[model samples]
Target: MAQNLVLIAGATGQIGASVARHVMDRSGWDLVGLSRRVQQHVPCPMLAVDLLDAEDCRRKLGGMQGVTHVVYAARYDHAGGELESVDINLQMLSNLLTAVKDRPDLRHIHVVHGTKYYGHNAGPGPVPYRENAPRSPRPVFYYAQQDFLIQQQGGQAWDWSISRPHTFCDLVLDEPRSITLLVAIYASMLKELGLPLRFPGTQLAFKSRTQFTWLPMLARSIEWMITDRTCANQAFNVVNGDAERWSALWPAIADYFDMACGDPEPERLARFPESHSDIWCDMVSLHGLRPSELSTVAQWAYGDYVFSPEWDVVSSMDKAREHGLTESIDTRQMWRDSFDFYRSHKIIP
Candidate 1:
């Protein structure tokens, strides 16, 4: 049997870490991780390389032999605008592909993307977005990377796959952009302050339907994509296969913390979390929890972006199911599981 060695880029991120963990425990496989910061727990051969620098990527990844698969989970978030985001992200993917183009042993490449391909970041386009949905007019990095990969693989033996997930929920302790963590921390802070677990968006947002992708579910889908021949050169939407309104879910979240759920307050997280920093510190000290300030533990602006959206955002999972990747997760259970992990890890009190 030929050895299967997989190279996972952005190995420390939520999605990438999930992929690394899934691949690491399996038999008959080898894992290599590429990221700027090496993670101590990811017990794999790791290289600290910046993908944006073409020469750096070449020098670091050019010499690797016997790499059978590449999972490109890396991303570059540019706040300036979409054009800059696309340019830098495309360049990073191009550099990595250029460095590894000569590997004869490579057989598959998987790209992880999200619903931003449908212009969710700008505004709502259509609900339950399918794989065949029309492309948004905006310059999205997913499109650029996909186009570049297709162009580069013109005559190559290896094929590629793309997986699109939405609103990733996971228990990565150091990740600041997790909306699930934001909710947990916010609720905990409110409980400590003798307040209710209030919904912090408008009524429209509270009732809007939404879906999430549990990181592990996404990891499994990516594994299927790389190993299954039916998934080659295809794009699939990977989600939890369920949707819920915050109006219905907020009470369950409150139940987790033993607090009462309050009505929607229409507040912006950008200003709310910062204003309550002292309270968060007091809770941390009182409960002997992890020693992290609120600013370090959560991104309030990201929370605002996630919670303030009044439009329903969902993606169809038919494509993935048709291709034999039929994993699903309950969104409510996923939230509770994530909160339990955070509490057990002392991330929150």
Candidate 2:
């Protein structure tokens, strides 16, 4: 067997964190972590290097021997909103690909592709986006990013795989990504207020769509794509095998918080409580949400896109399943796990 030296860029991130740990537990790969701040020792050996500098990335990575796989999960976290995502993500990916262009020992490249790629904000995508479907320029980043990979994949020697996942849940010691997180916290607040029965939205936009994957499950899929021969050079959408609505999820969160909730009316959320804002810190001193600090309650709430059954994201798992990877996690349970962990870790305060 060939020495499976896997190089993990951005190992400190949520997905990257679990990927390293999962590889350690399930496989025999020698891991190399790349990050700007090597503050805490991760689960694997690491190299502290800035990947933004193309030459630095290439030289340091080029000098490394036996790196059979590379997982590029690192990107700029400093940018506000989605403004800098495209340039930052595409540039970093392009540089990394350029760095390893001449290396033949590498067998797989697993890139952490986000959701915006499927459709633009409040998009009309073909529900359950298939890998073979038409590529949209909406994400702005997807086109360029895909171009880089397609250009590389054309070569007979280089092997690559794209893992497009909906919002990742239950990250390692971090907040969940999908709007569901906000839904849980908001429901908790409503419960604390002793509201009546929770109301399901009558609107028709989001009712028909659902897709999500827990962090661990996604990490497993990414690992399979990197190591398994069947997954080579294929693009796959990975999600747990379950679905639900905010109304269905609110009760669980309300129960956990020991509060009562009724049908959410326009009046209740009309005031736009300070707790619901993305910048929660600014509003904490004004309201008494019972927390010591203003933890953004709406982080999980899909921003400006809140009509229940109004909008959605449905990622297809067909490609990955075809590649012999069909592991699944319960969506509701996963969200509950993330909420429990966030509360325990004091991340939601």
TM-score of each: 0.95, 0.81
RMSD of 2: 4.5
TM-score of 1: 0.95
lDDT of 1: 0.86
Q: Write the residue-wise lDDT of candidate 1 on 1-349 in tens digits.
A: 3389999998977788889888888888888899977878665778898998999999988998898999999988655223447888889899998999879898999999888888776777777889888899877889989888899889999999999998898767788889989998999888987899989889998998778999888988898999898888888999999888888989999999999999999887777756888888888888899898888788877777778768888888887888787678988888998999899999888
Per-residue lDDT tens digits for candidate 2, residues 243-275, read 566556555656666666455453323234544
- Count residue pairs with overlapping backbones in model 2: 14
- In model 1, the runs with Cα more than 4 Å from the true position are 39-41, 77-84
Top lDDT: which candidate number? 1
Report lDDT per candidate.
Answer: 0.86, 0.66
